[model samples]
Target chain A: AQTVTQSQPEMSVQEAETVTLSCTYDTSESDYYLFWYKQPPSRQMILVIRQEAYKQQNATENRFSVNFQKAAKSFSLKISDSQLGDAAMYFCALVVGGSRLTFGEGTQLTVNP
Target chain B: SAVISQKPSRDICQRGTSLTIQCQVDSQVTMMFWYRQQPGQSLTLIATANQGSEATYESGFVIDKFPISRPNLTFSTLTVSNMSPEDSSIYLCSVEAGGGETQYFGPGTRLLVL
Candidate 1:
């Protein structure tokens, strides 16, 4: 079974600063995908970024980037220039082709202004 | 991008009653998933609904307790039967988009059983 683990339960970042949330997974499959989802108070889960296992380069979307280390099974989300709107619960998820997605415990991010 | 909408965004149902939540997607999708998010907890997969087939439930979930229906490629419904306090959680519907692994989630339906 594939499992995702998020070590940080809570994190805070000052406005205009950056914060990184750690995530690790256990998967034997050589091909997979990683994603970061942000759930705001509205309870709408939004896709933050995505990374493909075969890609060596990290994925970047605006201020959101992922440091994906496939060998170590580590996929961390980096939020740069944090803004107040970034406050939410962030979840790391893993997906194998045509299979259900496994999600991390999630990290509650607070943007301190 | 696919846009999804869930009916009865939030509801307060009494125990022993069943509440059916509807999920509608703007575009057809091959895979649709239902998830439950307990208070202060991460999302847990309840079942996977595919068109023209019975829903595949995950471990610890069953059809009697949470019956699901996928009538078409772009519509599905999940019913919480015999609701209890434990069933009071946010139920979400998600669909695969762009033929990639990424999933787009709908605005969840919050159920509060009393």
Candidate 2:
């Protein structure tokens, strides 16, 4: 069985600052994928970024980036130059091949101005 | 990512009433899925719908409870039958648009069974 854990329940960061959300998982599969999704109050889930296990390079999309440590089984999301729009519930998910996705409890982020 | 939309964004229905949520995508997609997200919880896969075939349901979910319909590649629907308070949750339909392992989601239908 695979499990994803997000130790931080809530996180806050000043506007234009940086914030890192921690995520860890336990999976036996060597080849897998990690993803970060964001859901705002509107209840729409948006894909933030994704990292492939085989690739050592981290995935970055403008302000969003991921630090994927395959050895430690850790995939953390870093939001640089955070803005108010970045405030939302972030979820860390792991998937192997085309199987079901195991998601974490989620971390609620607040961007303070 | 494909443009997706769901009907009846939010609904409050009486107990024992069934609600059907529709999911429509802008382009033809090969794989479509339905997920349920309870209050303060993560999303769980309910079933996977493919064109011209029966939907594959996940464990803990049954076809009787969540009857799914996938008539084509661009649209799907999920019906929550014999609803109860426990069934009240946000139902979202996602599509494997970009292919690979990524899935894009709909806005989700918020159901509150009274």
Candidate 3:
């Protein structure tokens, strides 16, 4: 069984600043995928970014990037130039091949204006 | 990326009642999944709604309690039967697009069992 863990229960960042949310996973499979999802007050789940385990280069999407360390099984999300809209509950998820995803407890991000 | 929509954005039902939530995807997809998110909890996979086949449920979920139907490639429904206050939660439908690993999610249906 694969498990995702998000250590930070809550995080706060000022507008235009940067913040990083830590996530770790335990899996025996060598090929898998990691994802970061954001759920706002609207209750809409949005994909922030994703990283493939086989890829050495980390994935970056605009202001969001991930530090994926496969050996340590660590995948952290970094939000730069944070905006108020970024405030939400962020979740880290892991999935292998076409299987279902395993999600972490989540980190509540608060963007202070 | 695919656009997904769910019916009855929200509903309030009495205990022991059943509610059916619909999910529609704009594009054809091969994989569709249902997830449950309890208040302040992480999302948990309830089942995988496979077209033309029975849904595969995860551990802790049963077909009698959470029935799912996938009539076609882009449509699916989940019925929560004999609802109780503990059943109150947000249900979301997701689809795996052409990409094998990435999943697109619906807005989610909020159910409150009184």
Candidate 4:
């Protein structure tokens, strides 16, 4: 069974500081996709970033980027220059071409001013 | 990215009743999915609504419990039947866009079964 694990249940950072959220997954399939989704208090989930396992280069979107280490089965998300709006529940997800998203227990992020 | 909208942003329903949530996408899409999110929890894929055929349900979710309908590419509905307190959760619909690897989600329908 493929499983996504987010070790940090809660994370806090200053408004302009950097925060890294760790994520690891167990999957037998070599070709897969990893994602980071942000669910704010509004409960609407937004796509933060995506990583393709075949691509060695990590995925970056604005201040959000992923450190995808396929060999280590690790895909961690780094938020740089974090803003107050970044405070939300961050969920790491995995998909193996079937389109079904397997999500991990989210890490609640708190941005302190 | 697709602009998706769901009807009845939030609702309070009585137990034993059923509520059908509608999801409409701005553009045509081949793949649409239904998911359930418990309070303060992660999303769980309930089923994949296939066009013109029966929906493919995930393990632990049944067709009878979560009957889905995808009549066309831009529209789908998910019905929660015989609702109980345990069924109180946020139901979300998402569509695969771009390369089919990325999915854009709807705002979700919040349901409270009492």
TM-score of chain B of 3: 0.97
Candidate 3 C-alpha lDDT tens digits along B1-114:
899999989999999999999999999887899999999999999999889899999999999999998999999999999999999999999999758479999999999999
The digit string of per-residue lDDT tens for model 1 on B1-114 reads 699999989999999999999999999998999999999999999999999999999999999999999999999999999999999999999999975678999999999999
Collision pairs in model 1: none
Chain B TM-score of predicted candidate 2 relative to the true chain B: 0.98
Interface DockQ of each model: 0.88, 0.87, 0.85, 0.79
Best by DockQ: 1
**True-structure lDDT of candidate 4:** 0.93
Clash pairs for candidate 2 = none
Ranking by lDDT: 1, 3, 2, 4
| Candidate 1 Cα misplacement greater than 4 A, ranges | none
Give the Cα lDDT of each candidate: 0.96, 0.94, 0.95, 0.93
**Model 2 C-alpha lDDT per residue in residues A1-113, reported as the tens digit of each score:** 89999999999999999999999999999999899999999989999998889999999999999999999999999999999999999999988987878899999999999
lDDT of 1 by residue, A2-71 (tens): 9999999999999999999999999999999999999999999999999999999999999999999999
Task: Please give the distance, in angstroms, between residue B42's alpha carbon in candidate 1 and its true position after superposition.
Answer: 0.5
User: Model 2, A39: alpha-carbon shift in Å?
Assistant: 0.5
Against the true structure, whose lDDT is highest?
1
Model 4 spans > 4 angstroms off = none
